[model samples]
Target: MAHETFLKEIGGKSVVEQIVDNITNAIINGELKPGDKIPTENELCASMGVGRNSVREAIKILGAYGVINIKRAEGTFVTQDYDSKMLFPVLYGIILQKDSANQIVELRKIIDVGILQLVIEKLDSESLYKVEQAMKDLETKITTFNVKAKDIFEADIAFHMVLVDITQNALLEGICFYVDQITRTSRMKAIEKFLTEDATEQFLLMHKEMLRVLKEKNKNEINKVVENHYQYWEKVNS
Candidate 1:
């Protein structure tokens, strides 16, 4: 395939950004496959009618975003696998947005509902056992007297992480991981609120309810169960 077909002339401000968009669009459109060597700096400049500096800046940005890799001797290539660096940009974007607290809650609800549905479809004995263990750990943390809110928060995160991981989907896991990071502060605050209100047991019960619902594998109950699980979180976050 001629790689030049992926290149197009730039016609707007921010030449570097337009170049980035062109290359990313090519990747998205399947013109550039994983491990495909992108056009060289000179070629990109010539094809896009941009200067070499703009091409270099666009390449640098793409490399930082983990969209492509630049080797010392080898040419730049599309990443072949999931990269953690890709999450930072998204995480920062959400954090910097106005009313991000509510936005994060909404995002979590959508992701959690989808994750539970996937887990229900793919739940196996081993995965169920792991998830059960996670719930048990959270329960223990909650029941312990004088336990720090941070400890409970860690256990809570672990339970959800297990749910996300059990699906055995790498992309979903990555997205969930970053979402978790984005909500870490709000979730920690929620835990503190629960501890202050002496509502830790209620929180524990919520996790139990989630596990019960998961075992039942009832699609109808997933949304309600997830909504209930986030009640305390939504309260503190809102």
Candidate 2:
């Protein structure tokens, strides 16, 4: 909330970016709580020694991400349900970078292993049925050799998402949502490689075994499936 803090151009970043960073930081640090009205456009421009256009553009960007809500005649307030949606651009950029490709696979491997037990514990018969169907459909799509890679990729995500949804954890769901989203392009490419260079039928069998292990309630089997699946995806990524 210090005007002087905004005045000092400590880096070569754009004025608009700087303002957006400062406001987001303030929200993160609890300096600006949810539902708190932010300073007006005029006040912000004057205090930061920036043009009205800069402030307006920055605010507009924030609004688009659901970080702030602007109500005519009321004012702009920090969103009550604000989460990492505001950081989508930054997160998506990092995830899609060529250098970050392997790291993305590694991240998924970690989350996949971590969620197995939670999913096993909560999965009901209906969910199990749904998962079985999803895997079967994805198996057919991949094995048929006629489906587009993009369609296969989407089906693959949907298949995994059935298990992810079984956990009933909002945070887990949100992370998976964004991960599936920003990597859609690269995942399509990986599926093409998988379809051409990998054994689609064996992959389908492995998926069936995964379902079987879940149905049998076998911890050791689940651990083995997780390890094998991790390796399976690693090859697909290449």
Candidate 3:
């Protein structure tokens, strides 16, 4: 293939954006692969018919998005593994969307339900033990005298994360992790409400029900348990 074909001439109102699109298109089209060295700035500028400044700006954007890495002397290359930074754009988009609370709640419910099914199908003694331990930790945090809302909230996150981790699905894990981040403030508020209302036992019971559902592998009860799990969250967000 001609070197010029790797990044075609730019055509758009935004030179930097066009440059970014060209390079990303090359990647999606398999012209570029993980760890593959990107064309040099001069090469990109010439091929895309853009100025050095445009190429440099586009490269900076890509690097910030975790799509590529720049080594001082070794040159730039596509990232070889997942980077948490990649999720920032997605997190920002969801957060900025208007009337997103209902949508986020729906997304969470679907993900939680599907994840429960996956966990049940893939459950093993070791994973079960880890989940059990996570549950115990949450219980202890909630029952502790004068426990801070942050402590309870962290424990709650840890417990759910263990369940998500058990599936060993990287994509799913990333989605869940960011969704948790997006809802962090609202979740903390809900937790505070629970703590204030002395509803810690009720909150703890909901998790215990989740653990019970996991152990039983009762697909029939998955929906009910998940619905109950989100009631407080939905109420608080509403």
Candidate 4:
């Protein structure tokens, strides 16, 4: 249980998973540098004493996640820019764990509200377009159909992500991505439960108010508006 508290269960206890750990460890230990082509599947199979199928599966998984890149005509290489520093923290939901998901939401409130303050301080016209685009996409997704919960969820994530993006902070983006992944269940619940026709309209109004606040660039009221908008989360679940 203690182990489960920290690590996500990847199912079937696949031995292929170890390949990721081994490769990551290699990267961390400086044995494998970014942009360095890794051994071929046959070579990896021989070296790791694993079957080629497992090696290929592990490589595919890492490739899918951008940890590695498989050049079509060339060989697979460590993703030159893969930051191991952010890997584990992001993988485990910024280290807050599933048990502390409420704290994660609280952290989101703090980060997001802080972002609102920054955005209000520096409301670039270019950034406003991105924010408006995300809002439009979110509204479209939520109102579309029963077939697109994922679309609604993604737009929901993107709308707030634009808030942070406007601040131009890379660390905040990573941290928010972590928080978003961790709090996805609560987000989905809030969207499904409270985003009815009337509620979505109300939601749009709240966002419009936030955009207005950003236009006005008033910092003092940033927290109040952010808190008010986020009450939906508190209304449904932590």
- lDDT values for all models: 0.88, 0.77, 0.89, 0.72
User: What TM-score, over all chains together, does every model reach?
Assistant: 0.95, 0.75, 0.87, 0.58
Provide backbone clash counts, one per model: 0, 0, 0, 0
What TM-score, to 2 decimals, does candidate 3 have? 0.87
Tens digits of per-residue lDDT for model 3, 1-238: 3547767655555988888888888888888899999999988877777799989999999999999999999999999898877777777887788878867888899999999999999999999999999999999999899999999989998998999999888878888888988888888988999988999999999999999999999999999999998888888889
Pick by TM-score: 1 or 4, better one:
1
lDDT tens digits, residue span 54-161, model 4? 888988878777778899989899887634344443556545465465566677778878898888776788888888888788777756756354677787777888
Clashing pairs for predicted structure model 1, backbone only: none
- lDDT by residue (100-208, candidate 1, tens digit) is 9999898899999999999999999999999999988998988897999889989988999999888888878888888877788889999999999998888998889
| Candidate 3: segments with Cα more than 4 A from true spot | 1-13
- The number of the candidate with the highest TM-score is 1
Q: How much does candidate 4 score in TM-score?
A: 0.58
Give the local distance difference test score of model 4. 0.72
How do these models rank on TM-score, best leading?
1, 3, 2, 4
Clashing pairs in 4: none
CA deviation > 4 Å runs, candidate 2: 1-12, 82-87, 95-98, 140-151, 169-171, 212-224, 230-233, 236-238
Residue 94 accuracy (lDDT) in model 2: 69
Candidate 2 per-residue C-alpha lDDT over 115-193 given as tens digits, one digit per residue, 9 for 90 to 100: 7778788878899999989987887788674777777777788888898889987767778888787667666665666
Task: Report lDDT (Cα) of residue 238, candidate 4.
Answer: 45
